[model samples]
Target: MSSGGFHVHGPHDHAVEHAAQGHGHGDDHAASHGSEGGGSSMSKIAMFTAIVATVGAIFAYMGGATQANAGLLKNDAAIKKTEASNQWNYFQSKSTKQSLAELARDLAPEDRKAAYQAKVDRYESEKNEIKVAAEKLEADSHKFDRQSEEQMHQHHRWAQATTALQVAIALAAIALLTKKKWLEYGMYGVAGIGIAVGALATLHI
Candidate 1:
């Protein structure tokens, strides 16, 4: 018991203090362990996010490059087509000149008929030459068109791969926020899918 300046403690009070001290130590130990685990999880998520972003950037760049190449090839096809049209026009002009020479031969006097016939023969040869050139130009135009189509197809694949990677990154952000074990597993699975798609792109599938 406590009088004027003296204080007294009962057995029950002492027991209560001991129990509180024990609980305090146990809580501190658990908290410290939990903080270490959370730090590790954060580091893992951050590193994964960075890697996925870098991969996505590379995919985006490849997609743009393929698209540009396709456009250039298509332009080449158009230019070739124009050149072929010009050649066909030239061939037509030669045919007209040949027809005129043939008509003159038919109506000319016997003495002058030979000269007109010679002109007709020369015009026929010129027409044949023009026809060959026009055909060659058309073939070149077709080749360019085929090449352009292939490039466009490749660009589409790259775009698809890039999209998958972006989705994976979004999932990673969600997992990081939630800190759920299932979410972490989901994040990994999505990341794997994204990488597989990227491989398909590289293979030109």
Candidate 2:
């Protein structure tokens, strides 16, 4: 307080002040490192989530396509079945006409008998042709039914894969929050299963 009319700190006070500043700097450095570490972990989790989301979207699209195909095949099968039934009805109508024609031939005069017989023969031929067409339509309907069932199975597999991927994404979020390595590993395992199922669906298994 002498020459410049200012108060001066002693050596001990200066030392104490320097120690306090050192402690503050140490705390700041540690806080910075912690923040950096947390940010890195969050980035890693975000990257993994992005990958899962991309894959899940692909699987969901595939599932929708398969389901639509199945519906189309089912509709085709229904159409074919209706066509086959119509053909069978036509055959039955021809049978009824043939029966009436045969009865008329038996009851007709000798001069008209040949005409009625010709009508009966024509009806028989038409009935045979209708039977063939109806059988073919039934076969086609069965084929369509089988195809629809196969597509539905593929759709189910895709659905399962998509669900598994969603669960994995949720688990990954939990792992990020809790910082648990085991949870992270479990997420990877579920994601692997989802991928495997998706591959199976692609192969139509």
lDDT of 1 at 87: 90
The candidate that wins on lDDT is 2
Please, what are the lDDT tens digits per residue for candidate 2 over residues 1-205? 3458877888998999999999999999999998998888778878989999999999999999999999999999999999999999999999999999999999999999999999999999999999999999999999999999999999999999999999999999999889888898999899999999999998988
Note the Cα lDDT for every prediction shown: 0.88, 0.96
Instruction: Assess every candidate by TM-score.
Output: 0.82, 0.81
lDDT of 1 at 175: 81
Per-candidate Cα RMSD to the true structure, in Å, reads: 3.2, 4.4
Worst 10 residues of 2 by lDDT: 1-10
**Residue 35 in candidate 1 has what lDDT?**
96
What clash pairs does model 2 have? none
TM-score of model 1 relative to the true fold?
A: 0.82
Where in model 1 is the C-alpha error above 4 Å?
1-26
